[model samples]
Target: MNGLPMVVSEPGLPAKVTIHEVGPRDGLQNESGIVAAADKAEFVRRLADAGLTTIEVTSFVPPAWVPQLADAEEVFAAVRDDPAVSPALNLPVLVPNMRGLDRALGLGAQQVAVFASATETFAQRNLNRSLDAALEMFEPVVRHASEDGAWTRGYLSMCFGDPWEGPVDPAKVVDVGVRLLETGCWQLSLGDTIGVATPGQVGALIGAFERAGVGVDKLAVHFHDTYGQALANTLAALRLGVTTVDASAGGLGGCPYAKSATGNLATEDLVWMLTGLGIDTGVDLGRLVATSTWMADRLGRPSPSRTVRALAGASAGEKQ
Candidate 1:
């Protein structure tokens, strides 16, 4: 079977797009078992090797909160060991609070992200605080990062739908998003936490942000394939001129806090679609497929990414 991705340029979508790879941190954090620091480092290295420049390596949340990333220090050190890693790589770590930010910055992390929830229910459940309280929590973190002159990103989860809240109000989501941007976030990634969003919902949310004066340039989309709407929603985001997309390599992870949140949109799948659209992601598809295949082997399971399975064949070891 042919593995080369066919190109077909579409109108509106940019000629080039930036992919934020979340497999290492967001992906692995949801695994039922803990992945060793060495393997996690290898995973980050392989992704960088595959030409994913923007990679979220690990989170600085307390180990008590996320045992999966208990070795955050070791993992960060191992990945940064390569002299060639930084100037060419964009490694961002998630910081849950002031302590998390302090730990990451202490290790010389140049880029950090703050995660928030659009809904009060999810905010309380995932963050153990109210929606307003969560933002109050991030204020200091973002401020400290700015003072330190490190790049900062803000992740707004449940932008589309929330498990406990049912369908979320697009306007409410807009308010939350604008608030996050006002908090000094360099970029805001809108998430479809439970994967219940369709392309229309995605477009409406983006339009809401646009109306609120949050241009597409400062926006990113993070989708999950739970309802198989990830690709469709991503296409909508691209058509609307939103360039940055968050995807997981080999469809590796979901929300550890949101139990219903399934795996993220796979990096391989996003790359294949972008390549077919004639959009430059600067990623080598074959190498990316191989990297996912290798990661799946180490994780002791088959990848859920169709592109990986199709390109790598039985080496993918995918289950139905």
Candidate 2:
């Protein structure tokens, strides 16, 4: 993708966008190899220096479940002492339950996250529980976090489609999302975990949330790049005034349920598109690309971000 058109034709678009960098948690969790804690801390510092307002530093999930994030406490401690990092910024950690939430609080995390699925099959497969069971488990955790004065964000995955079960019901998504909001979650991020959502699907989901009396101010989006529809879906969300977006550096994670699903929309690609559309993300594209390259090097693979490839190509030509 070449990114958003530079022509100033579109008259009405949001003035700013919030890129919630999830590389340390979501991105690294899905990697096949383990990333050192010190390297992860450096990555967080670099992303912060590059001006990413919300960087998901790590997850508080059990080490047996996600071995990659076993060093969550270490990573959290490392970033907490960095005086130059964003003062009021959030370093959200994915907390699966009260135990994970407790671990997050023990690490002095100001924000934590919980995730569920719209489909029962996905919920069971991913979280090893029925849909209702998952909600029940998250209820107390959300309530505890709320009472403690920490921000909690809930993620509803497979909002558009599921691998085991085809198209998911938008009403189900809205139901779970509303429940999450009711549980005192500060934000509910609807995730296209399989990247199967189109712009119309995005509009339908947003419409359902609207009709259910859920405020768009607390709505965010997390779209995968499986079918290359993430950017389009993001545009649709932006049109509906959704500002917060979850993205991974280097497009590092794919849905575990979908074999063909690629990864979360690249942070560089998202920032590039948003910048071209006159949406300020407060992220330095050059620095973001460099950070992606660093992680890609560690993984011994090239990044999948089109913007990164194009920028690298252009820089090479200039040097030549």
Compare the candidates by lDDT and give the number of the best one: 1
lDDT of 1 by residue, 1-320 (tens): 35767677888889899999999999999988988898899888889988999999999999999999999999999898866565668999999999999999999899999999999999998899999999988888899999998888999999888888899999999999899888899999999988999999999999999999989999999999999999999999999999999999999899988999999999999999998999999999888999999989888988999998887884435433
Among these predictions, the greatest TM-score belongs to 1
TM-scores, in order shown? 0.97, 0.95
**Which parts of model 1 are misplaced by more than 4 Å?**
84-86, 314-320
lDDT of 2 by residue, 151-260 (tens): 89999998999888999889989998888788788899999988899999999999999999986798999999888999999999989989899999888887545565
lDDT of each: 0.92, 0.86
* Candidate 1 lDDT trough over 10 residues, lowest sum: 311-320
Give me the runs in candidate 2 sitting further than 4 Å from their true place. Answer: 1-9
Clash numbers, per candidate: 0, 0
Report the backbone clash tally of model 1: 0
Question: What does the lDDT come to for candidate 1?
Answer: 0.92
